[model samples]
Target: MGKTAPPSIVVVGSGLAGFGVLRELRRLSPDAKLTMVTLENGHFYSKPALSTALAKGNTSETLVTSSAEKMIAQLKLDARIGREAESIDRAGKALCTTGGPIPYDRLILAMGAAAYRPAIEGDAAHRAISVNQLDHYAYFREQLPDQARVLIMGSGLVGTEFANDLITNHYQVVVVDILTLPLAQLVPPAVGESVRDALASEGVEWHLDRKVVAINYVGDRAGYVATLDDGSNIEADLVLSAVGLRPNVALAQEAGIDIGIGIKVNQYGQTSDPDVYAIGDCAEYQHGISAYVTPIMAAARGIAQSALGTPTEIRFPPLAVQVKTTLLPVNLLPPARNCVGEWHSVESDVDGDKHLFIDDRGFVRGYVLTRQKTEQRVEMDTKVGELA
Candidate 1:
């Protein structure tokens, strides 16, 4: 009898989830023929640096510690960097690319989300950018001059972080959003207000209840004049479209895979088709949400074990999404649904305080903290763990 050939696995995208699956798969099945494909050069690093760049005065190159070549050598896996997957032929079990088709027994899509930009008329709108990837951050950093005016279109987590960073970098920062409060949709109202105040004290401007209707170039200069719906206008050196993100689910949808807000997957990160799995921002898993990194990290081991044939049952816990911002001296952990609660604020010296949320049942489902009040994080974590 001939020796059975090892399984062949192909992973698309080189972000956290894709690389994570690749590493986990390698550990689970050493002999599996693995290949990774990415549209961008698969330089690996912690992506949270996108927001932290301004404070560090670091460019993308400074944040990216390893190149695709180095990752390939280190991980000992076949790599196809800077190549886009044109389509997937599931019947043929092959991925069609601009280069050629590559066959695989199993495929994983880790392609993340594209920044969402609302339809609005504007001149020099081409100057608007979303710093989602390292490349994008590098490009924007190079384009910025000292004391440049930056107008961000969202007051969400990403927008707030950028606002904090730009302030630290001495850039005049303005945040515009339809929501009356920054981070309203994420953190509770009180916590959101405190964060807004902190950023304001740092010289960040907030234009709540306003929207940009049009953007036009300011003469020949690399600038844009934004016309607000309120008949007010602001000229800015750059516009960052950080409103939100839409998952990359076109490939999965076209391949006849079930997709909702993202690629629908089971508890183990298995898609409708057992052989074709999804992870990261592209995957809507058992819990029905796929945005942050914590849940994705929790799903990695289960996905890997299943792909390698030594299947393991993994139950995912409700992971807390931590927002990294300098202005807000706190962390927020909200429940899954739009569950409401009353907040209790206790002052902790001058720099810190804890905001605890108690629901109708007197259960603490969420929490917000300042630097000094962060000591209760462990207590909140315990409650969250019990709830999970």
Candidate 2:
């Protein structure tokens, strides 16, 4: 008797998550009929590098590490670029894309996430830019002048990193956030204050506990006036929105798959339907969506195995996020959501600061390190165990 043929697997999206899963799948089952559909040009680049690209003098084209041709040939994939997966026909086991319907025995959704832009009442609101992809970065660079004043909304990781990068490039940066301090959700108050102060010392203005109520074109000024919640106004040559990201779950939800903050998936990356799966930013496991690269890479392997008929449970260890703010470098492992804990500064020396979140049982649940202390990231990771 002849050997049984491998199942056909269709993966949606071409971001790191999608590509990661494809790479793993090929490693596990080389002969599996694999297809990749994406809305972009299918060029592979490090998404995290986008935040620091300006300071590193990297253009959109230079940022691409691999072309679609290379990825397709290398992985032996039926690749479709500049196309979108419109919907999924669950019963037919097919993906309805702009190109055509592609049948698959197993489907993986790695659609990633989109930038969340706040709705502000004003004509200039449409002018605000958010760089979630290579093309968006290209447009942002094109609009920026040699010496520009940039107003950034949101003081989170993306916004803070861009602020630092812009400052390095000699642009005046002003950051406004509804939170009282930068990285309020990830870092302790002291660490956040230190970051805010360091950035301010480098000529970056901070507007905490405020929001941009409106943005208006300044008459004959070639800029916009951002009206704040406090009724003050900020004038800038450009406005950049780096609020956050929301997972792309519309397709899954429309397909009648279970949806939470993201498309809900089990440890094996299996969705409500065993044949269908999800990973990366689009997937919400037992805890929630792990949008960072580390977690995504870990999930990719498990997802690949499950798609290959070998079920594997994904386990994400405590992951540390390195904030790109070079002014006061930060390495943080955020405490679990709703964990009963309190953060205490364990050490503060010339090397920098370290804060640990200790649960009521006295176990270290999380840690934040600054400056030279960030080198302890690996040690801290081992101590923190699995993150929910």
Compared with the true structure, what per-residue lDDT tens digits does model 1 show for residues 331-359? 76766565566777655457666666777
TM-score of 1: 0.94
lDDT for 31 in candidate 1 is 85
Clashing pairs in 1: 122-215, 123-215, 123-216, 329-370, 330-369
Off by over 4 Å in 2: 219-222, 386-388
Q: What tens-digit string does per-residue lDDT give for candidate 2 at 1-388? A: 9999888999998999999999999999878999999998899999999999988999999999999899999999999888889999999989999999999999999998999979898888989999998889899999988889999999999999999999888999999999999999899999999999998998999999999999999865758999999899999999999999999999999999999999999889999989999998889888777889999999998889889988899978786799998899999998768689899999999999999999998889999999999999998998887434
Provide the overall lDDT of each model, using Cα atoms, as 2-decimal numbers: 0.82, 0.92
TM-score of each: 0.94, 0.98
lDDT of 2 at 257: 97
For model 1, state the Cα shift of residue 6 in Å: 1.3
TM-score of 2: 0.98
lDDT of 1 at 62: 78
Q: Which ten residues in a row have the lowest lDDT in candidate 2?
A: 379-388
Candidate 1 wrongly placed segments (more than 4 Å): 220-222, 338-351
162: Cα error in model 1, Å: 0.3
